[model samples]
Target: MDLLSIKDPSFLKKLSIKDLELLSKDIRKFLIENLSITGGHIGPNLGVVELTIALHRCFNSPKDKILWDVGHQSYVHKILTGRASHFSTLRKYKGLCGFPKRGESEHDVWETGHSSTSLSAAMGMAIARDLKKEKSFIVPVIGDGALTGGMALEALNHIGHEKKDMIVVLNDNEMSIAPNVGALHNVLGRLRTAGKYQWAKDELEMLLKRIPAVGGRVAATAERIKDSLKYLLVSGIFFEELGFTYLGPVDGHNLENLIENLNYAKKTEGPVLLHVITKKGKGYKPAESDKVGTWHGTGPYKIETGVIIKPENTAPAWSSLVSETVRRLAREDERIVAITPAMPVGSKLEGFASEFPDRMYDVGIAEQHAATVAAGLATQHMKPFLAIYSTFLQRAYDQVVHDICRQNLNVFIGIDRAGLVGADGETHQGVFDIAFLRHIPNIVLMMPKDENEGQHMVYTAIKYDDGPIAMRFPRGNGYGVPMDKELKEIPIGTWEILREGEDAAILTFGTTIPMAMEAASELEALGYSVRVINARFIKPLDEEMLTQLFEEKIPVLTIEEAVLHGGFGSSILEFAHSHQYFETVIDCLGIPDQFIEHGGVNELLCDIGLTSEKVVEKVLTLTREKQKRV
Candidate 1:
């Protein structure tokens, strides 16, 4: 039980394969117990326990590189590599990282969080080793779903063609957040079936070769016949044709089989593909049965019932509202189609998928392909709604610019999780879309004040056959506003003033509108009487109202949850300079030029001075500065 007291891979290396299997069970139990309290990635870590054990036993890590793609499954790797004692502090602030941290241990050769990047990083490490003439094996453990990403495929093509000395361990878990999709998933299925038959036929041919007096040339012909049989039976010559040696569809759970196969691959030359099948939640009952999208990544849950215990409220989440409304609209409209880059469950598109199964497409971890495909669908005059997280959308910027915007097609981009997503940290925050998407030409961007406005915006986007449009909404629920059946479209490139005052103005968009309101109310109590305007449309300026505000000679304060540079605040300043309203004071409040760390959403906001209290302080400071100038 005292895993750290024992030596690491040295001790693991001494154990028999059966003992290692027992240790795998212990690791799973330990992960379940500790992660129940810490709320780390329990399901993924549990699933990869046996695989991690087999990997360490066979490969000499810290010498032979092992890179884990998407890194959430690295918990077992960390525990095995002498951090078992620190398991209690996993995902805690400054305690231990949820993903693989390069600084945490030398054994973790590469750090990763975003999916589909392991192969590329592995290739870099492999090339370095080769240049040094070091014979260390480079193995990248990539999941079946991660292979769907464009970057992973590109790396695969390059590595295969270049004939690099690397081994790709394809962990086919059949899921990635949601189930895997696209052509790669189909190819892996064929490879698994081919591997099952190929190994059997090879054994039969070896037996025939043992038959003496079958002439030397005949034996050579038989060997060629067997080789040809392999090519005929296996349709997945995709990797082989690309130049990499294909070697698997191994039993990932079976330690002996995995060890034998991995040992063989290690001795082989050039890039090799080892296909290994695994279950997402191998030992856990509740997680194993969670096909409806509950166990991929979970919060704190009861180990017995697997019931999630987060603070629950019945208010409709923004994802559900958007999906439900879209499904309702698509009931009559046949041209409407829904798409996500492998996030039907996370984006709450389950309703749409069920109702319009033929119309919905889950592209599987490929954001670039999703955008371009949506563009192609739009070209056919079919209204394609591309549902994606704001952060993930950053991955497909080129597609949005070249494929979608350049053509000026009718594509509705539903940007969900459009602000600070807590716990998952900097890599997962959806805070930069307004800053990035606003500047792109032929792109109309909008964010809703509440769920009602979100519905209206969805309707507006589908009806306007002009060009590409995106509507961003925050992660959680709305402001408890009532819904309506009849939808109405708000005018594009415009803003609605929520509250009016003469002393100063507070301009904002999306969820920050509530924060701005709270700050304005607090300022009013202090006799400041600040104006609060909801600038829903981030791109096109509401020039008519802004000009009148400038004429009033009142100071303007812009607030957003995005970066300050090249954001809404910057646009207001540019407008002020163009109109020569230098006499009117202008200020901006937003996230500073630094990556925010992981914490509770409210805690993070207060720490970064984005809270209502911070906003009030900013307003008072600006007012005093203006008076000092006078």
Candidate 2:
């Protein structure tokens, strides 16, 4: 059967278990082949093929809302919901989204990209369902890794206490980016061999009955310890204590078992939790053996031999550069420690973890907790490098504010992927860190012009001993520039002049520096003296240089690969006005006041008019506008 002919999950109700198994094989093949060309969360999607099929077959979607936590695993869900033909365009600009998008299909009841949101979203939907008196099942499928999140735990407490008629499917794959850490993961590991939940309870009762108490104080104490023993030995008792009707340790890849368990969950009341154990990369051999998270989400790879196809770039990745630099500094600086929110592989902190096992901490899937933990380490006068992606850092804003910034601790935050990360789309875009982190008091924000500057900035951030300094870096490889033999600490709050001019000024940082230079060069060839300045330090605003620009009365053009609102560009504007430089011609160019979609980085840059062509036009216009004003 043609997988492309799959219209909707409605057709699945008519299929037998064997037919569904065949369909799962087809779905896996479709994902492996298509994702090889397109590049996506193939491992996650492959893992959930049978589980998603079983879900769609068991529950009536659009009416019976099914929410996928962290959304990357929803590719299989999308295929089942009449999106099989759109596989070729997966994660491309204006094409099929990698994550569940509400606009794409009505079957996508909830949109997600970040983790641990499904439970809360499901509770909200369940509340709405009850208020309207609608008869429907609300199922939220969340990974075990996501369960470690504070928000998910909070939601779990509420959902259980409210006794909401919902089914929470805990997809325990034992890996989230890398292997999951924390006590919760251990609990699930023990639960894996503890047999069926009811059997564990009965077995515990049997053991309790045979304790051989000789009618003494020991017998009364033994009777009192019955409930405590269940918490210790019984399977799924952790969820049972949370007021959920615990079910499973069910095999997620098994269609028959999954369907049967899902049916049982539908019949049960008061928020049943079906703990389905799955393999991260179920079907493909290369992905199946992924001990690290290389296959979690990947670029285009060769299907036959499982070699990920990447362009030969001599330049080191931004993540590797920063993490390696930190590791280098950690050898000399005894106070330095590392923390990441379940992104050891993504952030390239494996080297750091290997070198200093005691100092490194991988706090799984809890960004807020990771931030606070960094803050906690800071209180002990320990230099904690809180490595996190820009998008995920948004989740820890309050912790950053209340704990890291408000307390004025020395936490060196290495902001990874600090620009428009192309393929992962809006939810994973690192564009808003400047906008969010800029306004916070007692905190310094900066981004590097290149990998060489990035390493120096990492050194600078570590040595500064200032109140919460963050260095933002882009996602991909650097410009492959010559590195200085010795590392140097750049003076805080100072901007670097890459090229000088008199007609106008182009001030930008990070990935946009080259664009600024290209625009400046074009303007110069056309007989315009455009100065290109790398405004690396986002905060403090290079006031001395701004004064010089104001005194010279040169038209200023600020560019960034970030949101325009409250971003670096906005900061430059605010400085000019506040310092009584009202006559100074200033223009800001960046990602417009909208969410950027998934595409190639260059394609996204062109789409948002962040290219050198756009920069040249902006500069020419600004200079012309200034000439008229003069």
Candidate 3:
């Protein structure tokens, strides 16, 4: 019963159903208590406790690969695989990861953070297993919401065509982050209540047997009619048509039912879709009652009252500032519309949706479609604001280039969580947006120094009719800066001078601005007059200011909270080389060429040498080089 001492899931196979049920309760209690302190995907993990136990009991994990889609619900899997002892350090700096990691344990066969990837990964592993003549099951536990993704659908088609021997556990909880939408969700809804279809089929077979005295022609016709009736009555026939043996709308929480259905799926030939119905946040009332998906992922909360523990009197969240600004602008401009890829809650677009439901659209996890939809709106002279996270925007890169950028449409992209999202780790980090979006033509990229400027930038982006423009903001709260009564447009290709000095210039924007200022002040104390420039516009380099720096022969140091390669700093280097400023001393500071792991934003920055100390050192080095050349 001591969950912390659990070494592996081998003990699960020996336990009786009653013992397993008790263990499931213990697991839930452990998760509720531990995650309340550490904070995690509580609802998802709670939902999967019994199912995960059933899985471990049914299959040998390290041998039989159990790939988890999105990996958020892997906490139970982690605990069973001897990771319960690491709960205290979950999502902390260089500690236990929030998602499945290949290095964490051999049981974690595949690492994933994004949704709808497990099916494809499972297919590949299944193929490899067949090639090597290995005898182990390939199970990919996918959510109903994830099943709607374009990638998942594509995988479903391919796996069905190939008829690979794998068990596809369709975890139907009727939610994915937010309440699921679209036609597939509707079909699953019908299937959830189709338990009587099996009984109907049996009765039909008995009635057919009673007509044995009929001619062969009539018997064959009756058989055909019964088959047609089966298709009409059974909701899982859709998957059956795709070459999969359809089983269950089994109760996921019931260990006996789960074990029975899982065993059936394992024994079935070719691909089998085992539809298991589950309740999201099964044991916890607060999470169970959650309708809008607020409890899907959460911060630390009180176990007694379920009240989220939050810092008091903090600045507005960056998402709220941006979304509210867009909402405010939408009141004045009828042409302005908002779109998100099933992130209405995360993007903080509820205000806009409440005010103008017709103008707000949640496209339901289809990033590619959302991008092209925005482009389509832009082509019709409608100003569409595509609100998306930096990491997810990677899914729509082609749409951004081909539809929005190539057509030169006026699309406003609000890139939220633009840099170093703390808890979600490498897969969810927003560091690569600058590199990915910078090289795309007809796209103007910028980040604001503070929330006040952020609102202004939002205005500027919506008003810019030339082409696609994006304003990226960080994950957490904005700096509590004063607000202006009216929003105004900032000129494109311009940088703001925060401080003036003669020794060197520090160019940076967004979350890195404060560090640059601190570094400059520290340098001033040491008798180095370092100028600080807010390089707000990442694309279309500030030609006038850059030329002034080159003419003055000021050594330059660029800082960014993004990848160093093909980022803002790289753009600066390209500018200097193109402008015949070959002799200018330049240095750059940013995230190194590696995937930053799970940690606090500050800690990750420190690890990569993007802190003020690094900035000061770089400034000292660049100025010293300039002095040596002089």
Poorest 10 consecutive residues by lDDT, candidate 1: 195-204
Q: Against the true structure, whose lDDT is highest? A: 3
> In terms of TM-score, which candidate is strongest?
3
**What C-alpha lDDT do the candidate models reach, one value each?**
0.85, 0.90, 0.91
Model 2 lDDT per residue over 66-184, tens place: 99996999998988888989988889988999999999999999988899999999999999999999999999999998999889999999999999999999999998889999999
Candidate 3: Cα lDDT at 309: 89
Query: Comparing candidate 1 with candidate 3, which one achieves the higher TM-score?
Result: 3
Runs in model 2 with CA error above 4 Å? 199-236
Which stretches of candidate 3 lie above 4 Å from their native place? 196-226
All candidates in order of lDDT, best leading: 3, 2, 1
TM-scores, all models, native as reference = 0.94, 0.95, 0.97
Cα lDDT tens digits, model 1, 1-630, are: 667654467677888988998998888888888877878777677778888898998888889899999688998888888898887666655567777878788988887778999999998988888889887988899998898898998999999878998889989888888877778788888887776643565667777778788846557798577667668778777777677767777888899888888887887789988888888888989887777657878778899988877866667889988888889889989999999998999899998998899999998898999999999999899999999999899999999999999999989999999888877777777878888887889999888899988899988888878899999998888877888879988888889889987778899988888899998999999999898998998878889988999988788899988888888899999999999998888889888888765667787787788889888988888788778777
Model 3: which residue pairs collide? none
